[model samples]
Target: MKSHSLDLKSELLAANAMLRTVIDENPNIILMKDWDGKFLIGNRALADLYGTTPENLVGKDDGAFNPNTEQVDFFLKNVRSIMSQTETQVVLEESTNTTTGEVSYYQSIKKPITTADGKKQILVIANDVTELKRVQKRLEESERRLNYVLDATREGIWDWDIPTGIVTHNHRWCVIAGLDDNYLSHPLETFVGLLHPDDSADVKERLQSCLAGTAPYRSEHRICLENGSVFWVLDRGDVVERNDEGVPLRMVGSFVEVNDRKKTEQALAMQSQLLNAIFELSPDGFVSFDEARRVSYVSPAFKRMTGIDFSQVNGLDEVAFTDILVDLCLPTGKFRGFDALRKKRVTDKSGGREFIEVVHGGKRILEVGLRSSEASMVSQILYFRDVTHESEVDQMKSEFLSTAAHELRTPMASIYGFAEVLLTQELDAESSKEFLSIIFKQSGLMASILNELLDLARIEARRGKDFVFEVAHVQALIEETVHGFKQPSWREAPKLVLPVESLYIKADQKKVQQAFLNVLSNAYKYSTATSQVTIELITTPFAAGVGRRIGIRFIDQGIGMTPAQLERVFERFYRADTSGNIPGTGLGMSIVKEIIELHDGEIELSSNAGVGTTVTLWLPLIG
Candidate 1:
């Protein structure tokens, strides 16, 4: 009996030792509280949490260990509820600070148990979950930030579960699609239905390609809204979540409205096409330069005018290109350097326009204008127009005014001097009559000059509008003009020789007769008394093409002009006879030239000083 009692005590000692080991080795805090919330049993883990030994914690309430009133109250309340059988078990979370000021979180479980003394005790179990809760809070904050960013951008966000065909989209997605909010959680088909019919197949194809791992999910397509309006969206996405087999299980993307940008691009394309057409078809020349001053465009007219093919010089720098232009068009001693001109134009605050004289195949005048606007490539545009004919007309006007002024002075001097001589003289009837007759003749001469000047002016003022044109025989016109020239006492009547019976021509008959009459008058005016003037009409073919011309030749043995005088005879107010003996205005030959040019014919005059003079007028023949 003594040996059995000793063995029982050893077994009890071993059981207590095993229980202590189990309690100390467990990671959870295990403890028991009486129904009144006082500690009755405490394990090593529980004592460690309270910063005390298990024996010190016995019979103590939560007030001894936890300074937080709310925590202590919560602990007592959970224990009391379990002890009263109001709850089978209580599970809760609590946070506390340790002695080292480190925060700790705990998940606690409490259950009621009946002791051998018939009193109820609450068993408590706690596990530390501070790190897990910290991580969870961080994930929540990150998700909130992501949502804020998506909302701030005002972009539609979408997530698709490929396997389930379920689509999840934010509120903004519904707004962009012009649909109700219920569409946010709809199937993928609902979203797909909003796509424009023309773009639906392409969108699906791109999506399928991405799913098949052939391409990334990115596309631009149009979507139709409920209001029957279409909007352009730039959709970009990638397979953010994938299965182990590289299959796309989910897709995330954003829908950005690209309608404005698309419209702008299309408008720019159309403008470019229109500008290209203008460049090809415009009659004037156009050359554009980028900010870098390289040749950006060259028009067809520019190519034709310069004979410098644009294809060969398209990329040439401005300096080199300007040099080529200067070499080709700038005449010696006339125009300034291109660089200086260009710099002046650029610096001028006023509208940058420049006029220049260029010697192309002949002489040419060009007007260059520079234009820049914000909408341009921030580039400079150069426009060129040829004004050579205008320039020549201006020069002719200047010369005509100077000559007319000089010619009027000579006639005025004669009239003024003769009239003064008659007014200041005291004489008999014969002398008075002689002086009056002289004055009357000079007055007649002045009247003739003024009438001729007026005639020429009127003809010029109304170019061909007042002229009556008709078809007439050239031979008859020449005969009538020659017959009207009266024989001078010094010269014989001119003989008319006709090579053809009838040479027909389209002409202003009255003007043609006036022109031929002027030619015959000049022949008689310059020839001597014994000289015989010959007028002959002949017809010839044009050398340039299949055309015919009738020629009228006036041959005279007269006081012909020298080479220098002959050159100036056709100039207004320039006479071949500077000796003041010839009774004629220099305007006759100039008028003859003008009339012939108006008829689209040419007048040629060849003369020798002592020999005879030959003047031939050529006119286009009628059919």
Candidate 2:
């Protein structure tokens, strides 16, 4: 009996030794809890982690270390799940602290522990994952930001496996081709097939060069889509890895759609061609100079007319030409001793001088006239014409017109005023009516001729001044102007349509009224008796200085002018037909143009001879 008792004690001692060895060697935290959730056994690692000996921890509930009841409840829930066979293994994230107050992340797992007699307990294992969690979070954040940048810039990302010819593309790459995410794992041949036939060879060659390590893999090519549309693509990539034989093993690249940029380049190329044509074919000599007066560009005609070689004169400053001209003028007070040159006047020689003259080239003498744009205090553009023949003709015409106008104005005014007075006097009723009609018609004819002469004089003398602007109701102005044209002699009164109520516009009221009346009268005279005349008022918004602005549009429909008539419609006294059949002085449109411009507004006319005409007037709406 003594020997048997000693043997049993030794077996128990051996079992305890094995359990201690197992617990100490465990990489994870190992602990045992009783049914009441008290720590009954703890490994050396768990004891060391809590800064306590295993003996002291054995009888303590989790409150001794974890402290928080919530934490204890969480732990108990997992223990109960394992004990009830609801879960064979459970994982949870828990926060814990060592004696140093340093926070740590732990991935805790719980499992059921049963005694040989089948009484259940809880076994908990915890793995430290603080550094791993931090690294994972950082990686996820980096990926998110990278995706954001790619999305914002509309960049397409791709990866190519050189060995297998398998291509993987991100969603954006598909979107760029007007597709969806259904072709990510498509073969490289699928991409190659989409390339324009003309661009395919160059692209393949570039790829081959990259694979052979002979060049960087970058290229631009035109790509065709399934929808029969084409786009430009900028492909860029690098070799990610290489085999011992120097062949690329893996490659990565991006596809950026550059179709818009390509279109812009093509448009610029066309514009350059147009400019080149203009420079080569233009009759007038065109030149541009920098602020320093160095000639930057000159048309082909300029080179021919000056007899100065471009290579020798390209960078020559305008000061050099001015100095030469000044020297010539000082000696002869003329350009090469020409009489007309001597008669030229310089208003403010500080800017420059422009006049007509005859210049003598060494081989041939040519007549040249110069009229300059308003130059800055330092720079000028001198446009010249060969006007030797035109000057003589203009002088003769000017003298004849001056004499003729003086003689015609006196008789025309008397004919117009005297007839009006005689027609208004008493006479027999039948004779009175007939005579009045004749007088009225003759007076209108005379007035029309006088008005045309006056308009011609105004244009020749440049007598118009800027308009006076004021706030006025456009609706009221329109009504007044239309009322003035309401005479009873017409076959039928034209229809007047005003769609909207009163609208306020910022413009010169008198000038606006005159313009509206001219347009309305023209429409009435040209249209059939039954034709309708519509005037529409529309408003729109525009941007102003740190605020908003309103724009008013006046649209009209009536008998339209022909294309040729429209072209010269605004020229003073320029009648479309001069047969004296159309009752117009021809000065109305010209005056209308001058007034509208003075008010800083715009007028546009669209017309078809038979269909109808529409005049659109735009004026600012002011408060």
Candidate 3:
């Protein structure tokens, strides 16, 4: 019996030792309070919090240890609530002041306990939650600030889950699509369906390429909204989350509105295309240079006009280009340097027109325009056109007006002098008849001059537009023109030299006859009565590629003109015989020259001062 009691006592002491070990080494505040709010038990944590040993707070209330009355009262109130609760347990969040004057938060769980005497007591267990609460507050603040920034920028944010084909987008994403952002998760089709049909394929291809790692994740494409309006957006993203195998798992990106910028770019592109079309269609030459003065562009007309290989001339300095143009212009005698071009102003007021004469297949007068490109400040532009024919016509008109005035004055003076004498002075019948005859002759001369002038003007003005061009035997046309001069009163007729075979040529019958008549009349007027003008047919080269030309030669043995007078023979109303004895208007040779030129024929006249004159005419023969 004695050994049994000893074993029981030993077991009881072991159980009490384990209980003390658990209470003394606990990490939490473990304590108990009576219904009166006096402490019945205290652990090491509670003693440490109060800056005292567990024995010091064995039966003390919080008021005995804590100096702050509010904390003590709060602790007592929680204890009383737990003791009074009919329920099993109660939990409360409470605060306490430490010995270091730092306030820390705790989650306290309390339960009512019945002692052996059947009195109710409160048991409290508290856990520190100060650091956890502080971290949570900070995170909430950061999230709020981030959302604020995103909303302010109105950025459309998207998070795509690759494997699931699901997407989570922010409120702004739906707003951009003109939809309500009531839900967060959507199918990938929700966004993809909004792409314009024209851009859908390209966007898909780009996205697939990026997802496959063949290209970067960026795109600019057109997207259609719910309102049926299309907008341009620039989408950019990166693989934010990837699997362990290096495959993309998720992607996050943004969509930025770029419609205005895209419209501007399209406008510029259309303008560029139109500008190029204008350059291509223009008959005039165009050249442009960049900021470095390098040849940036050359039109097709410019290449043809200059006949310089653009490959060789492109990127050359302005001086080199000038040298090339000057060399091409050497035959035309209008060489100019780059300095001259630089000196010209490029404004509407100035027009910047400069004449550059160049001989390509023929003499060409270039009216070049210079201007700076407003689109690019450092660039320059040049526009050139061939104006050779226009310039020559203007000069011819001016000369005709001057010479006509001079030629008409002589006959008018003669008529006036003779008529004045007949009207004012008394004379015999024979003298009066002689004076009247002179007046009639002068009037007839004036009429002839006016008629010839009118004929030349009409022919030139029509310029073959109304002429009937036909293929006729060359020899027949010559014979027909010679027959008009076959009058019975002539001292000698021109000798017609014929070719054994017939030659055909394109010519107008009446104009050809008129041309030959002027030539024959000149031959007869300048030569003596017995002089014979021989006409001959011959062949010679026309131009570079044009085949043989038919030549008709008219040789005269009359008093010929000096070199000075010969040069002016084709001038309208310019007569070699300055003494008014010649009975012809000086417009005959000019008319003859114009008619020949209109037929695409050339005339050559060689004269000796007193010996004779030789006139040869060349016309292109028909095939």
Candidate 4:
């Protein structure tokens, strides 16, 4: 009976120790406080939030640590109400750190509890939501800005599916075009039918030219309604999407009503305001020429796009203006089309030469268009549209397809060669099994490469939109990753040297774990059994700027890479040592880079030919 009593006491002590570890290790705050606002229980996280220890918070209330008495009173009032409740309640609670004055938000679940001593208290479990709140507020601000832009412009936005000849319009389109609310869908012919007889042919020609890529769609034409009503509108559009055959797949544009605007008292004021908004907000740059056909005004976007300021080019003729821009463009870009308008006056209403590609600084692709007439004041306008992203997308797609084909063919050839050898030759059981094994391994390698390619594609396309981001404690994540990691050749496990202070980040737990696992796996895979792999939290700044990232560095004493190999580490399907002994799909580092960059993080690596390699992942700290 005495021995049993001792064992029970031992079990009770063990349980208490486990409970303490659980409470303290949690990043979230957990605590219990009595109805009088005095603290009864506090975890390490809750104490740290107050810049104190748990023992110091045992009997103190908010007033003991918080200097903001009003905020403290408000908090205590809520605590009292929560303690008074009969059932559990959920609320979003906010707290401010007295030491740093940093505000934090939490989604807390508070439950009314009765302690073992018959004391009534409130138990709280709070998850950090400060980052989430910040993101939500930013989204709200962006939506408000978009609302103002759309409402202020009063333009009807429309998208056209060229292949299907279907048109979709914003709500404002109907009022501008004097259309009935009867149609759920409108065909391209519906819009074409509304064009005035005199203007219909010109409009068709412009649309055809835009579709053919000979000219951009910009026309002011009269619209004829069914009731014999006529109105004028500014119609502008661009082919936003195209297929591999260079055929347009989709076009998006806008319509602005200008019917009888010349007679309105507010016409000049409205046009001036709209023009100012365009010059300020539009991503496309514009350069205006006066009656003398000299560079008179340069939009802000023009300066940003071409680095040519109005002050520098004001009162300059066409020849001088083109010279400045041509200097910024490559000689091979065939930017000489602007010479067509060098001699023409501002009143020359003919179609200025269509878009001629101008490669800016050999990095950006700009499509330049010239118009002889814009407004009465501005006689000639030069428009510049940056097509760099579109151009890169095309190049990327081409490279992806070609690279995938070349990489996949190697494994397929092995599979085919091995199967052919097995079928044609009369082999013993051992040889047949070896051949079959070879085939199976190659097939598995192919699957891995395909899966990696798909993952890379999905990541690039969505750009972290599908990520479920949350507060991720780095130490716990690394421990979890290393605990499950293993390799046949790696005799020793990777050693972890972590910081004493907690390091936290907003991350997708699974993705970050995958990234850690990949890095650790590479460290072990490339190294010999006796080689050591070490991981530690680096407190130093990885980059310069405010809110710089913290590094989680992994160092491996393995067969390192040469400088040439290191340069291509993040290239898809690149292997430092392609010798089949070091097995890999070669896409691991590339995938790691894409994942890190999408998370607003960076990966830095250094290696020597005979020495070892060190990889550091720089991630933004949140808590």
Candidate 5:
């Protein structure tokens, strides 16, 4: 009996020791309070909350260390009530650790218990749930935001249970499909039925691919409605749940109407193609650069104008591209190379550029313009336009102004000098008469030049609109003009060679007579009195585009002109003979040429220095 007692005592002590260890090491708050609210058995967790050790907390109430007197009172009341109860009761309590300054939420189980000493007590066990409560709040907020987004978008939503083959659709889906809310069918069958025949197979393939995890479930397709009308939709979803073996169990997605967006994209694509065609065919060239200042695009015209192919310059950087352009272009004012232009752009702090003239090769002139791109990716735009013809026109205008002024000044100077001499000095009648005659002749020459200029301007501006139309016999017209000509008494009349064939022309009679008189007068004015001028009527040979033409040839035995002079013989105010002795306005041939051309006739002249001059006026003959 003694050994048995000793063994039982050892077993009991070990059991008590294990229980003490289990209670002390527990993470949850565990304690026992007597009816007087004094802590009887306190674990390490409960003692730590009171800022005391389990050994030191043996007969102590929370009033010693806990800062809340109200909390202590409330707990004492609960302990008294629990002490009276026969069955266990539960309560939740909150506590704060003064040492750690940590607030904690706890789910506490309060139970009434009887100690070995026959004292009534309350036992409390609590687990901290602060992190779990915080997590629950966060989840609720996230759910609220997601639901708000869904409501705002108003997109058609669908959920599919892969394993059950069950599908659920929102009311928006039915509205989008033009179907009643009560409509029901197999989900896959309804989906396949709504797809256009052309897109059905591809959509199914892509869906299967998505299921196989090869690609994403994203597709744009046309959906046929109840009335045979079709609209485009962007259908997209992803696997929301997967089994442990990686099989898709659920998918969630939405449908959005993209009909208008698709149509706009198609129209923009067609417009882009048209612009590309224009760039390819245009004479102007363009170059585009990327954000890195590398060449991004070169139009076909750019390659043709610069003789550089995209294959040669593709992917070239700015400096390298500038080198290529420098090789192809001759420098203009303040522009040494493309790099210099880039610097200038930076200096000016502007994108707009003036047209810079650069000579490409020997004859071609190119005007270049540049605009810096404001887009984030594309950097700048460069354009080249061929302005060679416009440049030539500008140069010709300058020359015309200079030459016309020079010619007019000569006649004015002569008239001014002679008139000033007559005004300033008293002279004999013979000398005064000579100066007056000089002045009179110069004034008349100037008047004739001014009149001819006005007539030429009027004819060109009207383009034959002011002329009277008539038909005249070519031979009769020539004879009448020569009869009216004031033949210089010092020069003999031109010899006439008449044709027997009767030839007629459609022309303005006065204009035709005026042309003949000018040519005949030039013949008399430019030749020596002994020089024989002959007018010969000959038929022009048959030639394409020149129907049966009658040629009136005027052959003059006068001082002829060189090839250089012949080249500019038709120029206004240009004279083959620049000597002061030649008494002519320098406008006779120009006037004659203009009138003949206005009548749809042509003139041909041939001459050699000191030999003779031959001129033929050809007009279309009316049979």
Candidate 6:
């Protein structure tokens, strides 16, 4: 009996030590319940959680601490479940207090506790999961909202598991594809089969490219519905996940029906193409100019006629080609020659005439006359023919007439000689002197007419002459030209203005001087006697990629030409109605244009009928 009592004491001590360790080390709310649902043992955690001590909790019904009826019932149910199964386990939800009136969530599990003699009690283990449960509820709400939005918008959402070729579609996605709920479970190929046959290959290629990571997965294609109707859909997707090797593992995307919008766009594109065709195919040259007189559009005929490509000429100001027109017109100051030809509405005939002279392959050619429309305020269309041969023939006719007049003058001279011999026999000294003076004057007039005819012929034939290029000081050129014009021959004295210093330009000196002289002379001749012809020399920067250029402007308060006259001012032999009896060869402006162009510079002319005219020149500045 003594040995048995010692053994019993040792066993009891060990049990107490084990219980103490569990109470100290266990984080859970450990407790023991009897078959009557009375708490027999409780750990420190359980006591603290329930606002009681372990000793106070002993032999107390759970109702002593767990005041909540649902919690008590839950505990009882778990205890009963464990006891009935002899080792059954169950989870129970319970609320416990941490501070006054502060409740927390907990999950409790109870299991059967077997005694050494095989009788059963209950052991319950509880864990805190309040924060976890709250987070879970939040996530569920967010998902619900997202799903509601997608459904409301009718966007067909889908997910694809690339490795397994499995696709899941939302209800709307299935409905859009003319499928039922089972569509989510179907193979992805099922949807591909619904694509229009003509688009199937392209769709497959795009999808494969996306899967291979070569391109983004996006496409619009027509889908054939169950009822044999078709609709266009815009599908967009990107890989959402990748494997270790960077291969696509999953993709999520959405589809939207765009049949109506696509159809409308197609129709509009067709109409635009039709309009463009009509504009391109029209026989007449079509052009549009902006307010700045820059060429906005030019048709094919315009390009062909001018030997200027639209691509090269577009965006260039109309005044930029003043030199080109002048070269063609080959005009004198008073009557400039034609520069180009155009077909005119001459009593229903489509005949064209050439205007100006042009150099082609080192030979001069004249452009025939052509009709032009004067409807546009800043632009005109010209139609003309090549009249180089015809002009030559006309020149030959003039030379023949001059020769005939010269031959007739000799016979008349002989008659005058014999008549003079008869008159000398009977005339007084004063009368003889007068008769001889008259005869000399008539001979001089004939000589002057012959000289003018020869000069005209030479000018017509020499239209294709090559120009000598040289570096010329633009400011000095103007000053020199103005100084020369200061001769008493000029009816009106004009004011000459120069830049502060000399500015050099790349051009032929003589030709440029001639051009300057012509313009100044015109200004002086046309201006009111009291009004000053302001020759202003100003320079400003131009866009030259690396640096800037110098621009020169000449402003004059002269008798400016009307719009009708300005339009034809650059034409060969073209003189304004106001230029009547003006002592000028219309070719002066034409030559000015040619010289400036040979220097690769630009000139612009702007004038109002009564206001004045402003001529601006742009030339590259020397380094």
Q: Is candidate 1 or candidate 4 better by lDDT?
A: 4
Q: How high is the lDDT of residue 294 in model 4? A: 86
lDDT of 6 at 273: 35
Steric clash pairs (candidate 3): none
lDDT tens digits, residue span 1-623, model 1: 23543444444443333333333433446566777777766666667777888778777887888777788898788677778883544354564543554556665555555532247766555656564442221100000000000111236899998889998888988887887888888798887888989899999999988888787889988989888888678898878888888877898889877665454444334334323433443345767665576776677867766666777667777677777777766654233434555676678864455676666576667766654422233245566756565567668778877777777777677768767877887778887787777667767767777777887887776676788788898888877776676777656678878874667888888888888888888887788878889988877866676388888899989888799988887877777777888778777877788788888899988999977789999899987
In Å, residue 436's CA in model 2 sits off its true spot by 8.4
Where's the lowest-lDDT run of ten residues in candidate 2?
A: 139-148
Best by TM-score: 5
Best candidate (score: lDDT): 4
Steric clashes per prediction: 1, 0, 0, 0, 0, 46
Worst 10 residues of 4 by lDDT: 139-148
Error of 4 at 548 (Å): 8.7
Off by over 4 Å in 3: 1-256, 265-402, 425-433, 459-464, 486-488, 541-548
lDDT of each: 0.68, 0.58, 0.69, 0.72, 0.69, 0.59
- The worst-scoring run of ten residues by lDDT in candidate 3 lies at 139-148
Regions more than 4 Å wrong, model 6 = 1-466, 486-492, 544-552
lDDT of 5 by residue, 1-623 (tens): 23543444444443344335434544456676777878767777777777889878777787876787777788788778877987644445656686986776665556565542246766666655565432121100000000000112235888888887766788888778778877432466787789989899998998888787888799989899989888778888878888888899988788776665554444334334323433543456777667787777787867766677877777788778767776665556222546556676677654323454444445466656565654554566676666566667578668867876777787799889988898999999999999888888878878877788787777766768888988888889988988998887877777889988778899989988888888887777667789899999888676787777888888887888899988887887788887778777677788788888987888999998888788899888777
Q: What is the lDDT of residue 475 in candidate 2?
A: 69
Per-residue lDDT value at 517 in model 3: 80
What C-alpha lDDT, on a 0 to 100 scale, does residue 113 get in candidate 6? Answer: 49
- For model 1, what is the C-alpha lDDT against the true structure? 0.68
Q: What TM-score, over all chains together, does every model reach?
A: 0.51, 0.34, 0.48, 0.52, 0.52, 0.30
Candidate 2 accuracy as TM-score: 0.34
What digit string (tens of lDDT, one per residue) describes model 3 on residues 165-227?
999988877777777866367889988898988888888888877777786678888888877
